[model samples]
Target: MSSTAAGSPEPPSPRTVTPAVETVLAFVNTRADGTGRRELFEDGDSFADWLAEFGGFGGFGGFDGETVATDADAAAARELRDALVTVLLAHSGDEESLGEPLRHAERHLRRAGSLYPLATVVTAGGVELASPQTGVERVFGTVLAAVTTFAGSGDWGRVKACRNPPCHFGFLDRTRNGGGLYCSPGCGSQVSMRNYRRRLRQES
Candidate 1:
């Protein structure tokens, strides 16, 4: 295989995520340089752990001339992570029917109505970047801030909850025609079949 020939070799495909999924993924993947973890939303536990860490601080209150109790910190972290996951996971449907993890996630996302995930700010070498301000970070301060870059932009059309029951979570429909409705194509087919069966039962 040559370096740059289709017949010789193919370049690696790029990893792509729509703006909506990226929002939640960002929260799930934030890294804490203050701690050992170097990346955020890279994995599930880390996402949960970041919430734990963020919630540790009491309402973003910095340790003043006096330091706060360690237990207070832990409690705060728990609240933020749990709240974020909870708000995001809250669904219009029967939320109680969801699995434990899904229930937790829906709870985290419910607050976001037309606007999903929300946004904040992060500075580059000099310029600042808009991002979601994960509430915990604002209370104590953080390198990244929650942002609402996607709010009220008439871009909400792409935002969609996956039709697949298993992944009923939301994602931005990124097909050129903006027709994407599942996290992945396989799930789309699964959902279509499910809907088909549902219609058949109703018709019968």
Candidate 2:
């Protein structure tokens, strides 16, 4: 079994999620931060391991595990992942918690869109947008396509990153009113306690 980063928050239990949302969350959660940080794409071999596990989501395929990811490809993937995490933080209403400006994230995503443009694919069953590129570029395109699909269906807002600092895990908010702030109750309590202590310090 793959080892987790020391102090890394436990992976949340699996929940029912569409293929698109699943793809987005899987990609974004690769960077798990805690007392220590764990990056799944730290090297070419690690990147391949991650691809072997999640590259083939339903309706989004063509990523070959054998494809060697260069350092440039890994860097590009990290850029896209970080930008997506920023967007998900906005969806959770915690944009201010992180210093990353949403507009900057928007610009990065726009640049990525140009770098990995999607092609229109029409089939008898339905219309789809897919990437014509191969290898690592195709992986990037697949992730973009998933984001586009979920955003169009209005489900994009339901995906969010945890509000707690250093534990910004991505999760699907399944609450009835969609008011989920943190990934788990433990994280919520951590934030609440931190706030309470701050208030006490102010009064003291």
Candidate 3:
């Protein structure tokens, strides 16, 4: 529904049906690249702003909007976000795009898991993962819980970052075959054209 930098309308992409998927995408997209680059958790105030915007989402019930974020918390949030982007890049078969090795990213995620462990919650409706911590740590736990839940459903592979450089936007691949590579047709076209030019030069 959004237009690209060139004023072209982006093709309709599949919307995530699960709240878990929505949460993961929202968290990963906070630091999207290219012309739409955004760093939502640059500082304590900015991190607080991000919490105000997405803290009320389904899995984020433990977030305390009133709780203030420290600079340390903001830095941790950025580290977590980058690690997540690395994993999502792997999902899109572009693990090296972010320049962080996948193994390093995995280790960071493991460290994060220990820092913000998720708790199991049972209700009359069903069972779910919830964060016991409050404030920003809770936000991290909830994001991890979302990823775990969606990954358990076998749909985690569908959650991917765009393969196009400088436009590694997070998106849910809803194509029939789950072969989506780019976030939009424009990104795909850009990659194709670049590849074509490279091929021509090589042939020359």
The TM-score values for the models, in the order shown, are: 0.39, 0.85, 0.85
List, residue by residue over 109-145, the lDDT tens digit for candidate 2.
Answer: 9998998898877654456778788878888888898
Off by over 4 Å in 3: 1-16, 61-67, 95-100
Task: Rank the candidate models, highest lDDT first.
Answer: 3, 2, 1
Cα RMSDs of all predictions? 12.7, 9.1, 8.6
- Which pairs clash inside model 3? none
lDDT of 3 by residue, 1-204 (tens): 111234445523444456777788888788747486778888888888778776677556544567588888889988998888888888888957445578888899999999999887775545678789877788888889888877766677898888898878888898888899899999999999999999999999
Ranking by TM-score: 3, 2, 1
Q: What's the lDDT for residue 85 in model 2?
A: 86
TM-score winner: 3
How many pairs collide in each candidate, listed in order? 46, 0, 0
Question: lDDT for every model?
Answer: 0.41, 0.78, 0.79
What does the lDDT come to for candidate 1? 0.41
Taking the tens digit of each residue's C-alpha lDDT, what string does model 1 give over 107-144?
54344322323233333322223323433334322311
Q: Which window of ten consecutive residues has the lowest lDDT sum in model 2?
A: 1-10
